[model samples]
Target: MFGNICTLYYTRRKLIFDFLKPGNQCRQLVPEATVDVQRRQRKMTSPDDESRSFFAQTELDSLKGKKAKLARTGTHSHVFKATMDSRGNAQVAVKLVDLRSRGEYIERFMPRELAIIPRLDHVNIVAAYAIHRTPEYVAIVEEYASGGDLLNYIRTRPERYLQEQEAKPIFRQLMDAIIYLERLHIVHRDIKCENIFLDSNLRVKLGDFGFARELRPGVDSNTHCGSRPYAAIELLSGRTYRGNGVDIWSAGVVLYVILTSYFPFGSSKDEVPAIIKRQRSQSIHFSQRLSGEVRSLILGMLHPDPKKRLYSRRILAHPWLAETPHRT
Candidate 1:
């Protein structure tokens, strides 16, 4: 029985990849968005030219005071909300990474992120306006989401959780973004509520591609990246994992947290061992308030076996996402 299941799982995975491969019908599902993205691409210059023009023409307003610190500091970078003096004071998020910081991230992952972010042009993904690079620092100027990140947005809510109706649209938007990335063979290894942003209209804008990389079909990645709480079982267990499956697992965790305001696995990094054990057992306790379809969807995504996990196309087509939430 186990061997049969393994065979079926591998077959399903291959079918999913075939559906998502470039020039497939999956691209037709997002025709309008794809056209818009292409239009934007036409107006953009080369990354080097854009970067040089941005720095030469625009002056960034300083982020100095205590209140000026816009985002949580990472290992070697500081993020701040700033304005461009040349572009009529347009708001932007500036991520400044200090080159002097000693780490593999500074030398390797940071450059990968810089190179990838510019080529992407999805509406559901945050836009990178410019990238300023120097020996001392690397500054990434990106679109500013006025509504802030999903983590802070949920925490500040009266219920500390979103209703199924409210969460549905958000999840759909995230699915759309993920599907777009998957089509490009880009895997966003770091996907969590904190990395998901909301614009002024509360639309989802996926961001933070620091751990993102391209993973070709039939290839596997061994790097263990992303927040512990959102990491896939294969990643947490120190095994080679398909990048797409890793993303699906994290997206499941994000969905769970959006609806429950709690982690589906262990809460903190310290509980990694417990999380791994729980993942192996395929143990996930869901709230009764979530509909049967929602639970099933999450279960499909958070499956311990990466081979059996739902792919991007499957997640987007799930029945739970097709239902319309009746607005109050």
Candidate 2:
């Protein structure tokens, strides 16, 4: 019963700024020592025709005005895409926040997302290039994966499921990324097909860091923010829990969906809770497509009790992940 997922894209080309052409380039601040985005943004406080035109010219022009479908909407933030330079091919994404109202939420989300995303450097994790803070909106520029997302791939498959050969390597990469995040004490609270992107090589690139959080010693989260169908029981129960457990639970759902093109509990949104309730009390019904080993792994990960859930390292060791040697 999880809600729909959203995605965005951008790309990199050893970014080099040419401030001499200020008219051609929007403000950006790149870090010297690390990937943390540093940018010189122009803050505007008025909506005069000149202001509107200035923003219109600068905002749209910076992104090369190639807007893809907006991935998400907030009280103040709206995600969009555009070319970063004249290359037309060199793209960067931006999330424009209407700072006049509902800016507080963005203020909170921006810093935390910025803090965690840049620190991660993994083949499976998406890369962030720069952050532009303007008075009107805070735009985050990042890599663009033209291969779209995993959901589309799953949906296009026959019966909305991948063959074991197709699912193996993708699942392994996702597992590797999740395990890497777990080791760093970083939890990707949301893990679903939609949050997973594919590169030209079909390599998994985990995106969307808005719900990500770092767990300090003895700390856990109870924010209750996640897609419903893939949500962990602990999260749905409104109890504080480790980020790793929730992620593991979500990953199990992803694995099932990858192998079958639909949720194990059922696809109807309204019936998901009831199905999950039954699943918690009983066990999942296996489809003909799933192998016995695959079913077992899913059961262990989807265990109702977080304490009993199979986490990253164990999942990595699962036989299904080794059934074939692939890109993972």
Candidate 3:
């Protein structure tokens, strides 16, 4: 009886092992498991999966092409740099003028800049290359100045004093640009150090013509315009005065700052009113260290009375300027 029982147990164990194996009975019990295993195996080896895996790689080539195209051009109204084209054949600086910040001024002024700047072929002015206008954006393309602006140059080289010798040439160049504008009856109301840019070879390019206005023959502009520190006394006083005189006064202020690295008048914001009052009340002063001729020239330019201030022509012909030989 014990032998019969051991044989019966062996038979039952074999039958259970057969039932668990992959066959008709196991398939009947776990149909979904077989399908799931096959699906996973197919996913591991499928060409569709490989294609999806490499999709970004394929898209990258097209994106690189787009990036290359973007690199060739840049915007200016907002700060940006120039890029090279796909073939690397062209380079341009793009300026994006925000319609929101500028408002109606952008609509009125930008078109004028585009129409005016390209026609102006002066050596001292930055050349306008192109203008692109879209419903969403306005861009002005210009010649890229790798050397940046004069303000940055001066700030970076603080210890380097612009000696009379070095300054004379730059002054001459600036005068040429200013005189050219005057001849055209275009008054660059704003003339500050930052508005001037330099090329790689240190050639000056007067920029930012936003404040420029065409002066009709025999017409006097009484508009109060220009940076405060450089503005003439008459302009700050809200008095209608000669445009040329105002410009010359700014030039004098610029020259003074360039020479001494210090502003001649005012400190805090409240002091400006008093400074203007003083300019009207008293004669302008120069440090004792300045030469008598230089002092005389500056005072002549800064004269509170428009009639007394030196005109651009007279300034160019002044003995101080004539005596100093320009290097470049």
Report the number of clashing residue pairs per model. 0, 14, 12
- Model 3 quality (TM-score): 0.69
Off by over 4 Å in 1: 1-71, 86-88, 324-328
- What's the lDDT for residue 177 in model 1? 86
Question: Model 3, which residues run further than 4 Å from truth?
Answer: 1-76, 85-92, 102-104, 107-112, 158-160, 267-272, 281-285, 323-328
TM-score of 1: 0.77
- For candidate 1, give the lDDT: 0.71
Task: Specify the highest-lDDT model's number.
Answer: 1
lDDT of each: 0.71, 0.67, 0.57
Q: TM-score each candidate.
A: 0.77, 0.77, 0.69
**What is the Cα-based TM-score of model 2?**
0.77
lDDT, candidate 1, at 250: 92
Residue 124's lDDT in candidate 2 = 88
| Model 2 spans with C-alpha error above 4 angstroms | 1-57, 60-76, 86-88, 101-107, 266-268, 271-276, 323-328
Deviation in Å, model 2, residue 188 alpha carbon: 1.2
Give the Cα error of residue 43 in candidate 3, in Å. 44
lDDT winner between 2 and 3, please give it.
2
Name the weakest run of 10 consecutive residues (lDDT summed) in model 2.
Answer: 1-10
